[model samples]
Target: MSRPEVLCIGALLWDVIGRAPRRMAPGADVPGRIRHVPGGVALNVAVALARRGLAAALLSAVGRDPEGDALLAEARRLGVLTGWIVRDTGLPTDCYMAVEDSAGLIAAIADAHSLEQAGAAILAPLDDLPAWTGPVVLDGNLTEDLLAAIAADPRLAAADLRVVPASPGKAERLEPLIAARRGCFYLNRLEAEILAHRACPDAASAAEAVVARGAARVLVTDGANPAADAIAGGPTLAVPPPRVTIARVTGAGDCFLAAHLAAGLAGQPREAALRAAVEAAAAHVAGRDLP
Candidate 1:
């Protein structure tokens, strides 16, 4: 009856990615390699936590399709706790596809709208738990109404919440959390701007703006630039990413966030956690296995 180490709740889906060494343009024939692997914020963080030798559970909606079956098998293979996932009967499994160039991501598409409709079923078990404490990473792909509900819900309020904006389109959905000053946020410069509604020149400025918006704390990352952290009542901290060749951009931010949590949980200092996050994210973007 010890506490769960962490709960990563968000999209759990299949990712199909195509990559090419050269830059891409319209109507051009190109030779590229395609890689299909497990992805999504929930799965990525859960897998990373398991890889780091931590107990992690996934709370999200998944379909009962073949893709769901495969993902479930792999989740177990990676040692993530999947007992809390909500399996939907009618909806198909969620998925994402992206095209990447040597520079970074060129285009992407996500099919996760169904998960929005599935509501809060995945987290229902939290209310019945005997002892549920620890970090819970919440993503923004959820509907705004649902996000508001979660902000007010007693089941999740006790857990240390780490909030992430799933993507630019859903960034504004995190306003409820901002208003409630509930969780610590993980955001990129663009998503930060979307939530703050003003242009943020860098991660430092973004994190500051997030603090101004009533968030308890914030971590803002600008790709290849300096990252920043803002404690609820502490000073802003900034650190630059290590030099790395951009191979792809998919899931790099999630990797950074997960690595930060892992390092912090291991009793590392804030600077050390930031360094670990940078190294892990750099390795991910370079198409190497996480450190």
Candidate 2:
């Protein structure tokens, strides 16, 4: 087997998304389309990377139930490696459900308790390796304690670690990675504001604030506005995404991150990588596949 170019660690589950055609208000029943797809921060990014021709592997926990079995098969079909994933017998597969409309996502729920419960077991692979030098994409759905431990682990000291907050609610959980200054963070404007404990009106400010908080690098995206990328002590590079009609908003960020990483791995310059990321995300939001 070929060595993986990237390792994605976190939740692997089903995404149940209900999207309405028009703007939706609270307690209003409306016609919509509901679909079930394989998703989760880690899985989404892994699939995106695979579509970009990267050898990505997943190190996460999934149940041994039918859902988990089918998800693993789907990942394999998509060219994402699954040998390192843990099949937990104690828990059922995890899931995420969200409601979206013309404006944007109205609400969502993530039932990733199994991943949180699996804890360090999912990371046991790292214990056998002396050091991992490849890039690792970490999902913030992990418990704060586990995130902190991984940030401080010696086995990953030389790794290029990229972190993503699974959602705005889990944004604060990435503080440990920020404090360690060992990971590149991918976040939306609101998530950055939550982590930085201040209001960030734009993606540029949010990127700067996150870098100032001790991140090695940061990428901040504001829906339809502009996205910004910055390295520690470097000038922010802001790029606007194509103003496309919203199709679905669930996996846009993951697609962006995967495209950016693929661009970087292919030796694209900073600005080029940022632009590629923005464009890929735009395509994804327009109901196009990443490839």
Candidate 3:
């Protein structure tokens, strides 16, 4: 396989989503659809980049199980390089379960114990690969210690990094990267608030707060509100997402991050890249097929 233009490092697993077309309440049984798909923070970003015709590789751990086998096949089908993925014999593949209704995602659980256990072993392959100067999409699924190590690792110091909190609960795990100013942080409003330790009423304010907290760059999003992007010395730019009917919300942020990175790599200006990211996210939420 050819060298990948990007490396997505983090959870590589399955997403079991139960979707209900109507509003749902706790303990309320509603007719809906349940499907298992190849997903995870890193996988989602890699898939999004691949769809945009960007070659990407996954640096993660997957169990040597049937589920892992199937997941690898699906990733290959989607054009994501899986040769660097570690296969753990003692653990089951990780998986995320979520319930979504017409309103949006309600609740979810991520069972990534295996990846957490595999830890730095998943990244060992990096030593053998050619020098990577392209964007490395990282997620908060890594353990705090491991994240801290990465923040100071010389191997990654020169690469363009784009980091995202896998979920609001994992937002604090990214503090190491934030303090190191290692990457451009991509996260939703709540995640931003969790990192900044303060309430922000809007995306622009959230972006500014994160940047002030030692982040090199930031992209803050609020569902259908406004999304903001800020660089250390540049003005924070905010743009509203195009109106579109809601379809799925799971990978929306990944789509936005991937699109923005791709646009920027293609030489789009900051404002234009942010606009394209918002547009791409809107299209994803509108049920439009990516790429």
Taken over the whole model, the C-alpha lDDT of each candidate is 0.84, 0.91, 0.91
Candidate 3 residues 91-153, lDDT tens each?
Answer: 999999999988889999999988899888988877986666779999988888888988887
- Least well predicted 10-residue stretch by lDDT in candidate 3: 282-291
Q: In candidate 1, which residue ranges exceed 4 Å CA deviation? A: 1-3
Task: Estimate, for each residue in 1-291, the C-alpha lDDT of model 2 and write its tens digit.
Answer: 357889899989999999999999998799999999999999999999998888998989999899999999998998999988888638999999999999889999999988998998998877755589999999988999999999987888899998999999999999888888888899999999998889988999998988888888999999999999988867889999999999899999999999999999999999999999999999989997522
Per-residue lDDT value at 228 in model 1: 89
lDDT of residue 139 for candidate 3: 93
How far off is residue 85 in model 2, in Å? 1.0
**Model 2 RMSD in angstroms:** 1.4
TM-score of each: 0.95, 0.97, 0.97
Please give the TM-score that candidate 1 achieves against the real structure: 0.95
Clashing pairs in 2: none
Q: What's model 3's overall lDDT? A: 0.91
What's the distance in Å from true for residue 213, model 1? 0.8
Q: Which segments of candidate 3 are over 4 A away from where they belong?
A: none
